[model samples]
Target: MVLVSYILAPTLAFCNSYGTGLTDWNLSSTYGKIGLFIIASLVGSDGGVMAGLAACGVMMSIVSTAADLMQDFKIGYLTLSSAKSMFVSQLMGTAMGCVIAPLTFWLFWTAFEVGSPDSPYKAPYAVIYREMAILGIEGFLELPKHCLALYCGFFVGALLVNLLRDVTPKKISQFIPIPMVMAVPFYIGAYFTIDMFVGTVILFIWERINRKDAEDYAGAIASGLICGDGIWTIPSAILLIFRINPPICMYFGPSASS
Candidate 1:
């Protein structure tokens, strides 16, 4: 962690100097993706493979974000945090992002294989990249539907959260800042849990009950891990040393939260 911190300090400074914000290239954004796939295909089979693998990792990373956010929403429902503060937190990391979509693909694609041992569930990113390089983007496009499912589920959950928040009592609603975070798990839990139907119904019912207390809870949960998909994690770490209830100014404090 020490070595990592030392290296990233200068690296991040350079990015900010270049106007890169983490949210600038959030994974959900389609611009980077559309162009990336197009260019990767142009690079031929080899490049296409790399793009596909990265795409897979990107999918996982995104789903994880939704899951974590949903979890936080439930917590927020109980805590009653301020909405604006939570929103600020999400944006904090988003302000320092830049897109290196192709390179990101390469790194994550390679890493997937490096960590795993052989198993029937082998969609190793490296092999995926190599295949893309050889066959073409068409093959990459047909890779699988699993990744999309996760993202779709998360989005649907987000929708549910919004709907519940609208009808909830004003006082109770204060607890859950962002209801989507809780709703995400409710959706995901549908497929993974044995008592999925029951769990989901319970979650929805309880979510309504505590809706008033959920102020920016989802955003807080979202901020806690990647908030802005790592846009905040790094900066948050930098300023985390100041663990006070209220803010204290330091001239050089964590890039002024951008």
Candidate 2:
């Protein structure tokens, strides 16, 4: 499985990096699912679960790292920074993350009801990836009726959309839907989609009011929001660890008495 991952990593990373450049969306987990299916099928049911998960981890790391490095490189290029310095910084960050990420996950896991249906961190992708591994071990014949057909149809449709986008004029291509962006809501639910939509509306209004300012400060504004969201999570997690729940809980659902 390691050998297979090494062999596939370069191509997968290159594709993922290019896609990230185009759409600012990383599909590394999608590629990881492909790895999971392949490795699980090859290992068979006996121990396919572990092998498939291991392969998925290897593939996702390679693809995600490549995409992140490329994005940083793009920033360095725009700011006239040295490639060597950017590479070194990325290496250091990745090394730190290797230690920090798992520990942070452990903190969350201990503090919260992670992966539970009612938990905020439902970890939908983990369930999807595990199901893919099982499906691989069980073989394609186990797929529900018309599921494979639906998959093939969507695959072909995505290819056709890309082809059209590439061949069309810039104005038309700009309006064309990106398959990667579309797939996000399907996998992760529409909550983030709603957030994105709200952001887009805000940006549009800003651009209409002050085009130059919007163009100049848009990246900074977006980065601040993203960083703030991430940083806020630390305090939330710490509060949870201390058993301090928020005073107000908002629940949106049908009433049981209805």
Candidate 3:
């Protein structure tokens, strides 16, 4: 029902910002937790967490597939491509991700001490989901077991966000700190936030300088950047296999690349 609601009314997905603020993470994660709650209620506690995890997986897959379908439809409209061919291409890419994802994970898991202080990618979202599952099983009183201080912080933050949003004008609301932006450091740490800040600064400057051109080309530019980053990862992984670290990493201490 939640999935259908989002499909029919896309704005409903964004409405989560006003609630528990889980939508800040992403639409899929937010809805997955909803599914988790429902599944837990039906299955009872013993297997509820596992059931919730399964529900999260299914919800994410469905939401993501729907999102991808929409994007393909847009591209098909522009290029006049056949819908059948687009569907086949999407399936082929999905199959490739199934194969490549595990091997890529294995490469990183074997190469670095995952979840350690030194690791580059800490898998922060995985930790958040795990904690959410625990919370679903145990409820509010058990908050301290996970991290009571963090939970309290989130609660206070959400309250402030709601209050601020209420008083702020709609025209200026875009300038207000989004609940998701404030919640970032709690989930993924400050480094990712720093990266985001850099990107935001760049966007701010671009929009200020040439608002029209930025509006016109931003979509194409962003798409190219995403694809370029993904393409670069292949070579980066190959370099790792050959024990060749990045040039910048060589300047740092021995453990920097790890």
| Alpha-carbon local distance difference test for all models | 0.46, 0.84, 0.63
Q: Which one is best on lDDT?
A: 2
lDDT of 2 by residue, 1-258 (tens): 789887998899998998776546678888888888888988989989888988999999999999999889867865679999999999999999999999999999999999999999999988888887888888677878998899999999999998999999998899999886777778767655765676689899999999999987776676565445543557778998999988998777768844
Q: What are the per-residue Cα lDDT tens digits for candidate 1 across 1-258? A: 223223333433332222212121122222224333544555555555565445434443343344334333445555777656655654453343234555675777766654356744365755644454454466455557676577678668867776777789988776654643333345334322233344446446656878654432533443343333353445557677775343566465566685
Clashes of each: 45, 0, 0
Query: In model 2, which regions exceed 4 Å deviation?
Result: 19-27, 74-80, 91-132, 227-258
For candidate 2, report its TM-score.
Answer: 0.68
Clashing pairs in 2: none
The superposed Cα distance between candidate 3 and the true structure at residue 97, in angstroms, equals 16
Q: For model 1, how big is the CA root-mean-square deviation?
A: 18.7
Winner on TM-score (2 vs 3):
2
Residues forming the 10-long window of minimal summed lDDT in candidate 3? 16-25
Superposition error at 62 for model 1 (Å): 6.1
Task: Between candidates 1 and 3, name the one with more favorable TM-score.
Answer: 3
| Candidate 3 regions with alpha-carbon error over 4 angstroms | 1-34, 37-43, 46-50, 65-156, 159-163, 170-174, 184-191, 226-258
